[model samples]
Target: MTTESGAGARVNCVVDAEGRVALELPAPVAATRPHLLLRLRPKKGEPVTVSRTVPLEAVADGPARAVLEPLPALEEGRWDAFLLNGPDDTAPERLRPGLRDLRALVDGHLRDRPSPVAVRIPYVTKEGYLAVRAWLRTAHAEAGRIDVGDRSTTVTARLHGATFEDGAVVRLRMRGSDAPERDVRPVTDGDHLGFRFTVDHEDLAAGTAAEGGIWDVFVHPAAGAPPIRVARLLDDVADRKASFVHPAARAAGAVLRPYYTLDNDLSIRVATG
Candidate 1:
């Protein structure tokens, strides 16, 4: 896949979410099926095998390399890649109606974001309150309350149960400042379906926290209040917010917010909302 983003090559592409996520290999794919496969690893967990195959029907204008689309609020790094059929394939330049249709499908995915962004607010501690503004330096497992606005779970659980050791195949990597990448995988859904994904964050342990800085994760869902965690990192120095999430091995998630302050009082405060 080519880097240095430009209008990359266009090929029929399909990205799977929670539902009927399937890909059928094109005739060309008959020979390169293995390389086309991507093994997505969740945070400290075993990698989940995405076995679907998407055959390139109509090739369109795209880059020489697969690119992680440059969107307004997309996390900096994650799994955003697609490989070309040939090393020096120039199919994107000479586009046709068939290829044009393929380009539209891929572009649609980039333009449509199906994820959440972080919105943090902080305040000084009050009589019974521990000041909400300090979530900036807090961890998701420790910081606070989170409410997903009553949205029902999208991915099924029975499909994504833990079938392997945590972190063995899965992976968790921070992409952008506002939020990191959280991914999960399960063995099978209750109905015997193959698998599913849930949002979750990789434990940014204290040892890994930047110098003079303490990193924490939270579940503050209000977008106006400190998060409340029901599950948390192994050693949450901050707090927890169970009301917002149901901890599942296949759940994936990320965090985004403003700046934070570590004060002389040994207390922390975050930037404005």
Candidate 2:
């Protein structure tokens, strides 16, 4: 909660592709016993907790490193992160243990403290859990940028560290409760991929909107390639306030817009006139 980088202990953390949490510590802690504590509390389900003794691997007595294997993928919801000095009578500080629910977080939110030097962010997983992911100082896919309008919708994205095979195809797949999956291939452009899909006015009517007009976006590569979710990475969601989201409502005409959720996934809002 403190904005100070090393207010208590200066540490750096990251989440790897395999879903493990890795921690790096400064010089002083190499001699003292170190412990890693992780707590996951979902919005609607039981909480999860994991603890491990961090083997102090010395690097010139300066920076130390440790890795904690991944916990089971959580049920969909929001989760908070804490890198506490686990229970040790010999250590200087012992952070309180146990996970906290959303109400606990809201009622007892960290306040009046220096802005937290946010080492981790609360994220939402594909399955719908609000969660936290390990930080990686590497380039990855950024799918937060999207364009939605009454006539059509467009998406432009690039996959970092990913290469496309020749003759591979990219597509935008959308579905609603009332409509079947609409798979449209996006036009490939210079370096990034671009997709433009038309929306019929009739599909925007208020009656049709109520049946589930909101749409989620996903990247569909070639037939054999695993579909990549077009999601916002880190802190790159620029259109949080303006994007249209939520199911469509009855109105005079159809209004289409895009929106980003707290978990950083993109959804479309359809309002029919």
Name the runs in model 2 displaced over 4 angstroms. Answer: 1-32, 49-79, 83-141, 148-150, 160-179, 190-212, 234-252
lDDT values, one for every candidate? 0.24, 0.43
The deviation in Å at residue 43 for candidate 2 is: 5.8
For residue 193, give model 2's deviation from the true position in Å. Answer: 5.7
lDDT of 2: 0.43
Q: What TM-score, over all chains together, does every model reach? A: 0.22, 0.51
Tell me the tens digit of each residue's lDDT in model 1 across 80-177.
22333544433312111112112222222122122232111111122222111111122122112222212212231111111222232112333336
lDDT of 1 at 266: 14
Give me the candidate number with maximum lDDT.
2
Q: lDDT of model 2 at residue 156?
A: 63
- lDDT of model 2, residue 83: 37
